[model samples]
Target: MSSSSPHLWSPVRWAENGSVRLAFDQLTEQRDGEPLLLATGLGVNRLWVPDGLCRMLAAQGFAVARYDQRDGGESTHLPPTTTRNPITALFAKRGEAYTAEDMADDAAAVMDALEWHSAHLLGISLGGAVAQRVALRHPDRVRTLTSMAAVPGDATGLRTMRYIRLRTLAKFARLKFPDTPEGAVAAGIAASRLLASPNRPLDEQAVREAAERNVDSGVHDQQAQSRQIGAQWHGPPISAIARPTLVLHGEDDPLIKPGAGKAIASRVRGARLVLLPGVGHELPERAWHAVTTEIREHATSAHHPPAPPAR
Candidate 1:
């Protein structure tokens, strides 16, 4: 899938449910020796997963599809933004909240729009949270699960105060500076600086390029992003996920600590956790091979069935 190609391989339109519209781009080649469905992390349009990751996955023989979560990209953004504080909107009390389960439904709706009965699931960061809920809610719809730089909802991990404060600041920044290019650049830089492990510095040029791509792709919707974040923050339990799962985390990840991955793996039955030393929150080209390898292996093992008895 070239950058020049459309954001979605197919036209952007509403699903039968009428609440969510999906836009997706499909890879030209199939890797992992079969077709696979790919979803991007939160606050990202389709361009977040660079060509390197797409090409690598394609080489593995899995057809990759990347789409914008509702309210993030070209997909439909929720309407009638209230004058409520962004923080309050996200952490709504009780009945007023939208959970990760809703986002999972949106994902499944995307798969159904593409007419796929099931897909190999991959999600990064917030997308990982959404994917976790999807597998738990619709286990039969997932062939395998790959969660990269993500944490489960168990809350046993080392939730660093620095990371939490940074996230809160980032949200406020986005709400205040949703339009300025310089604001976008500053936000990305701040993110890189805060989330980057001191041991593994992200490439400055690469971060700049990614920021530019995000800026060029489209405007950020503060309300929608806030709502999604709130839903995940108040998400339900993850004990229901039964699919074969592989949890990947960067040891130096400052945003969601590696401990979160370990906790997630412990709670989910038979889940495998892989900690990548010296890596951070973002999935750069250096980490693509390892990430794709784990995904391919897990997805393959997930689909393989028991052998028949010798007659």
Candidate 2:
């Protein structure tokens, strides 16, 4: 693949529970390898991951797949829930009618479409939260679980973080997505700058391209973002997940802090935790190798059990 060109992903759609549809792309380089399904972050699409990283995972003997969540990319559009405004919803955490469990069903539907009976599920941020629900609600179908930069249910840690509040205020203070193409790119660039690792330089072009592709794909509206935010689950605690679980996070994450990751790892029985000291909310290129290594090792260990202890 050329560095100047992005991977051409042809997204096909799958409907779930008669209400939601998701757009997904898959690479089957390792046709029978453990199917690894990725759920992206909130208000974000699969394009958020660099195409190179996706290809790298595919090359490493894994059938890699990623999909847009319900409200982002070319997937289904859910109307704005008007019971509360965005500010109050963010602060008060109200008005969301759906939970990540619903989103996980969409994931199961996608897997059904692909005829994959079970998969190694991995997610980032909000995607990570959804992945947790998938494990909880459909434990038999999840081979292994990897959650990155995600908080547990209710996002209690995030709501308590001062930086999150400040960041929210700053973004809404001057938020605007211009109607033109250039404006869209600009909007993406700004968000990338804000979300990128504080320890690393920004990848402006990648962000710009992702934004442009998302715009071309379909509408990425504020309502969808708000709805997803409102979709935070208030159900059972995270301690009940029985899958081989890995929790990874950036210690410097401003959006969902390292504390959130730690909280999750503590709750899930035998869940492994990895914290990158110099990383942030968004996965930097530098952290991809670490992230992939954790995932590979976790899944491989799960599949290849240790020898018997008897002598």
Candidate 3:
């Protein structure tokens, strides 16, 4: 497969899910590869998923599509509410915007728009939690589940705090950037650097390019991040996910602890867990091969199960 141009993606498509409209785009044109839908984290848009990573997956025979969640990217941004900070929102008693179910439905809406009846789900950070919820609410629509750098879907309020690093959160809360487009790019680069593994060098050029692609990267939109973090899940927990599941966590992740991956793997029956060393919250180029390989193998195994031994 040839390397795909970062700017040469399918035109942005709209998926209408109830009151919200989601923005998404197809990164690959492979009809034979398994359909893979990516859900990004927090306030970041679909561009946050590195183009190189998507290209690598496409080369591995996966048709990839990524989308912006309700309050992020080009998606419908709801009227601003009282929630102003992600930390406060995490502890809020109730969601001031939408429920977690609505967010999961957004993923299904994207899949519907792509004409895919079912697809492998790959989500990172907040996206990871959303993916877990999608599998629980719409099991038939998810062929397999992959959650990376994410907490458990059902964990909420104080319970969710156990897997987070408060110091890292503090640092994120301290991040301040101007509201201009240039500031948005700076904020994105800074945030990416913060999430990058300390042991490896981050490719600032890739981050700058991605940020430049979306001037309104949403990294500074604390309100939207708050609403996303505050959205509560009332549906079944990760324990109820019946689809083949894979949990990946960075051992050196500064934002979310590796235990989050363990929790998801432990709850989901027969789920596989892979902890990557020298990896932080972000998917650097160094870790792309491992991540793609794992996802490819996971999807293939789910499709071709081992033959049962003769009795």
Best by lDDT: 3
Q: How big is the positional error of residue 248 in model 3, measured in Å on the Cα after superposition?
A: 1.0
Local accuracy of candidate 3 as per-residue lDDT tens digits, 118-212:
99999999999999999999999999999999999999999999999999899999998888888988888788788888787777787677667
The residue-by-residue lDDT of candidate 2 on 155-242, one tens digit each, is 5434534325366445743667666767656666666666666767666676666666654322224567767766656556678888
lDDT of each: 0.66, 0.72, 0.89
Worst 10 residues of 2 by lDDT: 1-10
Quote model 1's TM-score: 0.81
What shift in Å separates residue 113 of candidate 2 from its native position after superposition?
0.9
Better of 1 and 2 by lDDT: 2
Ranking by lDDT: 3, 2, 1
**Model 2, which residues run further than 4 Å from truth?**
1-11, 83-87, 91-97, 154-165, 203-220, 232-234, 305-311
TM-score of each candidate?
Answer: 0.81, 0.86, 0.95
How much is 280 displaced in model 3, in angstroms? 0.5
lDDT of 3: 0.89
